[model samples]
Target chain A: AQSVTQLDSQVPVFEEAPVELRCNYSSSVSVYLFWYVQYPNQGLQLLLKYLSGSTLVESINGFEAEFNKSQTSFHLRKPSVHISDTAEYFCAVSATTSGTYKYIFGTGTRLKVLA
Target chain B: SAVISQKPSRDICQRGTSLTIQCQVDSQVTMMFWYRQQPGQSLTLIATANQGSEATYESGFVIDKFPISRPNLTFSTLTVSNMSPEDSSIYLCSVEDLGRANYGYTFGSGTRLTVV
Candidate 1:
């Protein structure tokens, strides 16, 4: 079984400021990491994911996340955020061998971009 | 990623009633999953809908309460039986499209059920 933990419940930042959303997971075997964003009343959208190879992954919208094996962490970062980035971000983990294809999601971090 | 469409985007039903949510995908997918998100909480996997087989449910969820059916690879239905206020949440359907390396799962717009 895999579980994910997002450290922050809410983060407030000014427009154009940098932000980081911390995420940690617990799993014995290899796992796939993902970040999803959900706007109000909408479904989740895939922000990025860390599968194999390169530990660092990036999204088209200037968001990036690095998978740290030792720390069991995959924290999402953005150099400069815009007001459109304000939404609920979730970190998820799924076991590599588990054929169930179920992803355990974190509590979620609400990013509030103040203009 | 696959395009998913879910019906009954939102509804307010009375207690003891039932609501059936429908999900349709543009392409055939190997796996389809149903998830629930309570107010201010994260998503919880309810069950995995498989064609020609009983849906595999997770802990704390049962077929009696939430029945699922997948007639084909591109379509599935989830019925929330005996609705209660506790069942009020956003129900979403997701499909796994392994073609994309990073984006494997695509989600539906979700049905917001508010039991009164």
Candidate 2:
């Protein structure tokens, strides 16, 4: 069984300020990590993912996350955020060895970018 | 990634009634799943919509409450039976896109159901 933990339930940052949403997972086998963003009244959009390459992965929208195996963490970070960046972010983990192909998601972190 | 079109973007139904949500994928997908997102909560997998077979449900979910039908590889429907205020939430359809290196999942716009 796998579980994800997101300590921060909500995070507020001023426009152009930096932000980090932490995510940790517990799984016996190797796993893939993903970050998803959901705006108000919309479906979730993929932010970035870590499959098997370099520990660090980035999304086109200037957000990046590094997979730290030792710490079992995949924290999302943005050097600068905009008002448009206000959304709920979710962390998900999928066991690589599980053929079932199911994802276990974190509680989610609400990012509120203020002006 | 496959694109999903979900019907009945939103609805307000009476308690004890039922609501059937539909999802149609643009391309053939090997795996399609249904998820429920409660207010201010993360997504929870309700079941795996399997083609040509019974859907596999997750723990705490039952086929009676959430009847799923996947007639083909590109279409599926999930019906919420005997709905109540607790059933008021966002229902989303998802498909696994193996073509991507990261194996990311594509999600539907979600059907917002409000039980009154």
Instruction: Give the share of true interchain contacts found in each model.
Output: 0.68, 0.89
Name the regions of candidate 2 deviating beyond 4 angstroms.
A96-98
TM-score: which candidate is best? 2
Per-residue accuracy of model 2 over A33-114 as CA lDDT, tens digit each: 9999999999998899999979999999999999999999999999999999999999999885546665989999999999
Question: How does chain B score by TM in each prediction?
Answer: 0.96, 0.97
lDDT of 1 by residue, A20-104 (tens): 9999999988888999999988999999998889999999999999999999999999999999999999999978655545588
Can you tell me the CAPRI class of model 2?
Answer: high
lDDT of candidate 1 at residue A45, scale 0 to 100? 94
Put down candidate 1 lDDT per residue, B1-116, tens digits, no spaces. 68999999999999999999999999988678999999999999999988889999999999999999899989999999999999999999998868656465789999999999
User: Candidate 2's C-alpha lDDT?
Assistant: 0.94
TM agreement with the true structure for every prediction: 0.97, 0.98
Which 10 consecutive residues of model 1 chain A have the lowest summed lDDT?
A: A94-103
lDDT value, residue B39 of candidate 2: 95
